[model samples]
Target: MDRPSSPAAPAAQNPVQLYGSFHLGEFELALPIDALQEVVTFPDAIARMPLAPAHLLGMFTLRGLLIPIVHLGSFLGLPNGTDHSEARIAVIASGDMRLGVLFDRTGEILRVSTGQIVPLRHGSESLGLIESAFHLGQRILQVLSADVLSRLPGLPHVLNPDLAQQASQRRMAQGSRHQAISFQVGGRPMALPMEAIHEIVRFPVLEHSVLADSRCRGWLQLRGRPVPVVDFASFLGLESCSTEAADGSDSEDLRRVMVLRRDDSYLGLLVDEVDSIVAYLGAQLLPMPAIRGQAGLFAGCISRCDTGAHDLILVSAPALLAEPYMAELAKGHHDLYLVADDELRDVETTRQRARETWVTFHLDRLMGLRIEQLCEVIDYDPTLVRPPGAPSHVRGVLNLRQTLITVIDLRSLYSMKEAEDLAASKILIVEHGGYKYGLVVDAVQNIVNIERAEKLRVPAMVANQLDTELRQDLREIVDLPDQTTIMLLDSVPLMQRLTGNGGGSTVVAALPERVVGQA
Candidate 1:
């Protein structure tokens, strides 16, 4: 398997953070809210700073206050775009410095939770006055610190030389988490870049009755409105809690609701509680090993925090949103923030991003599998059953259109659990060695375009969880944050684990042997 070339970056500072990731032409930006103030309509607040530096685009007056507006685009070497339907004057403030950063348009507001952020790399060369960044979907957002942000990127220098050099070194570093929030899955924590979370919510009722289907359901009420709830855990191959954490810690409090944007919808993820939106400037978080012959989706892991128990999961939710079915639904639900890629060609860009990345999912609950290992995605056809006593993972057989397919309960095979937090599920059909089997998955997440030089960060115990034969195929790990390591999973070995010699022993053996008996 190939490795990702891009290594993890460091955590962002001040207000601008990762989950704050948002689109701007071909570029994306995610910073802290503290880095920004209110955004007013462009023309309405076009007040220039009186005799301010040229780096300063000018001042804009808003609500009677004279605020200086800077051209963030021009600073970033992009074409000046002032013609926007709803132009906005982004008022940004960091410490003693304050500037109204100008934007072509006010993109969506990202609510990065504790787990989505990673730190920036230390000793980076591309620093150029920008410190860290957050990745959202297919885009990356560069973050600017208070002093570092005095000027925008790609523009001529104006700040003091000494300060600039420090910022640059801080960037392009060999070490740093890059994003602010990250999480752990299967024991490995990936950075989630904070700008992505909208609001963090905690609800005691999140733990729902364990339903049989890949789907898990719970109710979400917001501002007096009742919205349809979907299971997010199952979507990401995570196990849902039957009840709250053992400590009972505020699981029932429903303290915070993390609202995130996925294409056309705002996702509200329920968290146990909110942790610090801390900066992660430790080591570069690395991607999981490449195993399934596809570009892997997981970016990298974030080590345990000061609390040491609940780490964050930094990830690209839109990648999971792209599966054909959910993509259609997101188109409507996330209507307000949708881009006009009405031309399906834009999707090609996403495919291009896939150069060699792959992602993991479960066919049934508990099974960890990758979509690349599968041939195509299909629906479960109960009417297609054929024989008895096959693998329990094998959900019998199904006839789709004109193809004879065998249904495999990958979820059951991989041991993936359902998240009662958010939405739907998907099924993938994989083929190899002349045998074609359809595997059920909760949802198709993002396709990772893993770079060759990626780093691996995970807990030591989890690294021990990697199948012995599987460890050799992993990318590589320099320094594990909090001493955590993530060993990427491959399909062939997983297949053996699901149905092979000497593998059907543990509880996981239930699906394969059961299929043999029930078929």
Candidate 2:
């Protein structure tokens, strides 16, 4: 056999290059590393691009720049990428057009040389976009043409003046359509116009207000200013779709609050939960029904959801957020200030006018504390340290973030029956004199809003179990719609009685330096 001749040496100028690779459907593909700009996770909201072909996913903001996501699978004749958590958008910039390609997941950056790149046979189909392939042991990787891939079909084919003008006109016609957010109120589906909405937020801690209207729920001090919260169901004259059990019991789960814009002011619309944002064509909306008094609340009805499920009642933004409602809210404040000086006012009168919100918890039966006085809530820790000669009420000192938080057992403090398993119990932190104390309870429940009209004075029977100081902490008793009664406790007096010995302050000193900012 003849010996094979040695391979000829090439010029030193052409060096191997690196390519960024990622899994596309069943196959792995590579693009020039220099062409790859970034890899970003999917955004929360991607604006739908009108008139764009299926291959063009949508427009998403990447580092403040709006970039388009291209469905690489569709372009390759494979199934389009689904909304999998592992899916990522690989941004590729080509000239003036910057876009992203969807992929299953990223792969390793591989180094390859021109000599190793095996050109496919002319008859073999490696999609026109795949210029060549590289053999790596048993696997073959297809290198995509970055230039041709960036120019997605249906995008400007020719830089003609007429084509650009037509695209601009199409976008302008689609801009005026309404975008609305759908949500559940009292189990009923409803929608608020996108133009009238400011933002959707998690239920925030609302400061109890005696001056605000009951229908308004209460006032939330947002960003140093008070924003009134409206009960969407109540405003619509529907049955309360409160999250708590029908009996007006307490719950700790967060609700969805939709902040809405009314002129220059903002209002928080409390709903059961928000569903999704959907766009509607003008012709899809049915004419508003003229109900005797409800004409102002309903703008139109959306016959079906995008899935053709339930019907959606469109809330008239202009009417729901009318000047008359604001006038009524303003009148409530004026009336409250008028009677502010009367300290000896009848309880019946206050109950009939004011609304109170309580943070309920359970020791044995349902119990509550005034929401206004609550500073914060923390989870209970089982590893709390017991100090020597601690009282029955003073269970132990908890090292919460290095702050020595004195935990008070509500059951022991009130001489009530304790639960066999206190593992799920929570600590309610109340602040007084710059010190914080933890009140341990069985379970934190829901927040219930009660009409002052429904509140009753604490009965003498329940009051007899406590000494005068503790008895004074009993705020009132209110009957829930579910026929259950909740005994409301006042936090200020309770905190004072629990920490009168300066024990909370002493506990703070005993805590390690790490807990200084535990609050």
Candidate 3:
């Protein structure tokens, strides 16, 4: 390994650092070391940004934002060596700007320059970072500038959304990010992003009341507030390291409580041990060493273990919480039970609207559309028109999206005289057919997911009772809470009719029906 020359003991002191020697292939360029930040091991990342400087080797991301990685050697007419990983990125900063310049491996930091310098005649020369030429013993070093490197040609381009997408995908696949938060679960090490953890609590002695039924640690008084603690081992479906439960002693077993904030929920994760923050470097990891029974619980492991270091397996938290035990634990718990499903979670939450809409009702003792559909429940607003010459079931016209839609009283059409309760007659504002419509219900109630299997054929026996015209559209018979099968109204044909026509406002009585198994 060839090293750069050590700094001369300066009876004369210049701390700004003059000669920052970086090897471009075999040749040396004198850069100002004081301007240089620490050299970091550059990971192999994808470059997708366009209109990049010729010096840049495509574009890459640093710290989640898009930043380009430039190939100094390629631009400087130096030999094209191996990839950037074999090289190190020498970070240089000037004033408010910073950039990482690539090198074929790292060379020594030498301080040497001519008070008055020279130039090379072999290649086409550039004026910027390769400032002026100077001489060391047996070598010529061209002085480089950190400032000029950043401001080279076409360096001020903004990020392209499409290129950002490609780079993000490439980052995940390559595991290029090195920084990670690590800990121990069941004596096995695991690591994740430090950004993921809110705070870590040490050795929380979960009361039997909390863990007995709820995976939640009985709310511990943290700053006078009850914070939910999750048993990490149990939640991950991994076996606990120790079988003994806490006995309410002031002194308890050591466990780490990791507070995690998801979109709509905040929960605690209980771990057997906690380790120091580590740099994962996107290395490959294993879940468990051996497939012992339910060994699939672990994600994967890192091949090389550095003493206290081990590759950490990242667990999918939502999948673990979805276990049958979650519902059981949530039973009787004060808080309403809801899955912290990231996939299902809406980025832009609408709680008031969501609550109002997701509600259920009954018409003739049968389930109406889901409760969540009713954006509002109020006395019939007479200001909205009542469509004329419709049917007995068509109660009136309601204004939705500046259009009049015939409001249907579902119970009357089904001929369930017992279903019509005057006090329970309320207007429901439903969103469908690319517009909003209103329904007059006999009774309104809590909304729930109608749990039903698919492709239900209303058997030949009950076929006569359903709509002879719209029979094909009834795809499934979902049994609701009241145990009566509610029909899932097919909205596609209705939407098409409403949108296809002028201002598309009305639900046509007769239209093409839904094929069975459509859902």
Q: Lowest summed-lDDT stretch of 10 residues in model 3? A: 510-519
Least lDDT summed over 10 consecutive residues: which range in candidate 1? 1-10
Stretches of candidate 1 off by over 4 Å are: 1-19, 45-55, 111-118, 121-129, 151-519
CA deviation > 4 Å runs, candidate 3:
1-258, 261-359, 368-379, 382-384, 387-391, 399-405, 412-420, 431-434, 450-455, 467-473, 480-484, 493-519
| Decoy 3 TM-score against native | 0.29
Candidates 1 and 2 compared: the better one by TM-score is 2
Angstrom error at residue 146, model 3: 43
Candidates sorted by TM-score, best first: 2, 1, 3
**Which of the predicted structures, 2 or 3, would earn the higher TM-score when compared with the native?**
2
Tens-digit lDDT string for candidate 3 (83-110): 5545666666666455677765433334
Model 1, 275-301: lDDT tens digits are: 333345455344456435223344445
Per the 3 Å backbone cut-off, how many clashing residue pairs does candidate 3 have? 22
lDDT: the better of candidates 1 and 3: 3
Ranking of all predicted structures according to lDDT, beginning with the best and ending with the worst? 2, 3, 1
TM value for model 2: 0.38
Candidate 1 overall lDDT versus native: 0.44
